[model samples]
Target chain A: MISLTDFLIVSAVLFCIGLYMIVSKHNAIQILIGIELMLNAAILNLVAFGKYDRFNNGGQMFALFAIVLAAATTAVALAIILNVYKQYKTIDPGKIDKLKD
Target chain B: MNLAQMLFYVMSFIALASAVFVAATKNLVRSIFMFFITLFALAGLYVLALADFVAVTQIVIYVGGILVLILFAFMLSGRETLNAMALQQKQFISIGKLPAFLLAALFLIVLLNMIIKVDANNLEWVKKSIESKNDIPVNAAMTEDIGVGLMTRYLLPFEAISILLMLALVGAAHLSRKGRGA
Candidate 1:
């Protein structure tokens, strides 16, 4: 029997890794990758706990919605990144300080 | 050390290792490939957790749709940005990223502490579910149940998400198209 704790630990580590990627990476696409990782970690948690929700399948349903939302967010973010690159000629988030007032 | 437990460990290792690579690697294209592996491994973990439908959805939507979109964006972006080799070489552990490393490590330690403190196996609802045999069986096919639920109980969110996706698609297309000045 694979305990729930095992799954939780894996996702926690994954989430932390994603957080590190988001904070440390200067590239916009790399940050998007990190966002995806964090979302996957949350989805993993939902599915793991959903195993116990036999009656409703709530966790799985929410995971589906979450995945869709992630896709949508990624699309929007990529589009914005492209626009930013166009205006600034670089994709490094750290260097794009035009909005810094 | 049952078969499921062993398989779970294998999948978890694959997912985490690739995720670490994705985070640490300086080569953007290589990290994208590693991210593919990470997503596939996570899909396997989802199956092991008895979310068959979700696992398939993860593979289909994530691998087929989102990753391809990301690749398209990568290709469309300027070569100067894509060619990240000359910019900086990022090691797994480096002095420049010390603050990020420390923050992530601290967050992991706190999360692990909280997870360990929660006795998930002996929780009241979990024990009750076990006693009543109300948990999902190991071999249950979740696709049909999920489909039914989507049409019935989750109909609102289902419809709402479709609308949201459509809006996002339109917004992305508009944003990515050339500006009037161009």
Candidate 2:
């Protein structure tokens, strides 16, 4: 039986990596990938907690909803990124700073 | 280590390594492939945790649907000028890179500490049988429970999510039209 600590540790690492990507990457698409990673980490945690909660399976339920939302979010974000690319001719978030001072 | 623990470690390593590649790799196409591996490995871990239905959903939605969509967008964006510009030429020398690295490190540390420090024995959600025996209820009825829950108590959110999905797809189509290019 794998311990819950193992799951938690993996998720924490995933979350941190996602944070790093979001912060350091200049590409808007890459940042969206980071967001997906972070969402996966959260879903992993939910399933881990669902192990003991046999009565309701609330964790699994939330994970389902989260998965659907993540899919929809990726679709919309990629469309937005495509639009951004059209406007700037570049996907680099740093170079497309219209509101920056 | 037993088979289960060994599997867990292997999957975890694949996920983290692929994620690092996704974040750090210069080639965007390579990053997307690596991201596919990361998501695939994560789904394997979900299976290990016995969230079987969620595991299948992960594979179907994330791997099959989203990754494919993202790849199609990449193919569409593959023009000469855009292709030349798409390389992640910006290294870790960006102004905020150091702060972001520090913040990620801090977040990992805090979460790991919390996970390690928590008394699993005293937690309310940690049922007595689970703590005493650590016996994961590896049963077939798990999917049945999920189905019933979705149709019964979770019917509202289920319908809402379907509606949200349709709207998002329509909005995405509208946003990515060819004439809107400026």
- Candidate 2: misplaced stretches above 4 Å? A99-101, B81-84, B87-96, B129-136, B180-182
Instruction: For candidate 2, give the lDDT of residue B111.
Output: 90
The TM-score values for the models, in the order shown, are: 0.94, 0.91
Tell me, what's the RMSD of every candidate?
A: 2.2, 2.8
* Candidate 2 TM-score on chain B: 0.85
Residue lDDT tens for model 2, B1-182? 89988999999999999998888787778998999999999999999999989999999999999999988987877675345445455443456678888999999999988988994545765757476644348764588889999999889999999999999999998898788433
In candidate 2, clashing pairs total: 0
Tens-digit lDDT track of model 1 for B1-182: 78888899899999999999998877888899899999999999999989989999999999998999999887866576565523634423365598999999999999999999996777888888778876889888888899899999999999999999999999989988876632
Q: Model 2 residue B91 lDDT?
A: 46
lDDT of 2 by residue, A1-101 (tens): 78888898999999999999998887787788999999999999999888877667788899999999999999899988887776667778878779432
Screening candidate 2 with a backbone cut-off below 3 angstroms (N, C-alpha, C), the clashing residue pairs are none
Q: So what's the TM-score on candidate 1? A: 0.94
Candidate 1's C-alpha runs over 4 A off are: B84-95
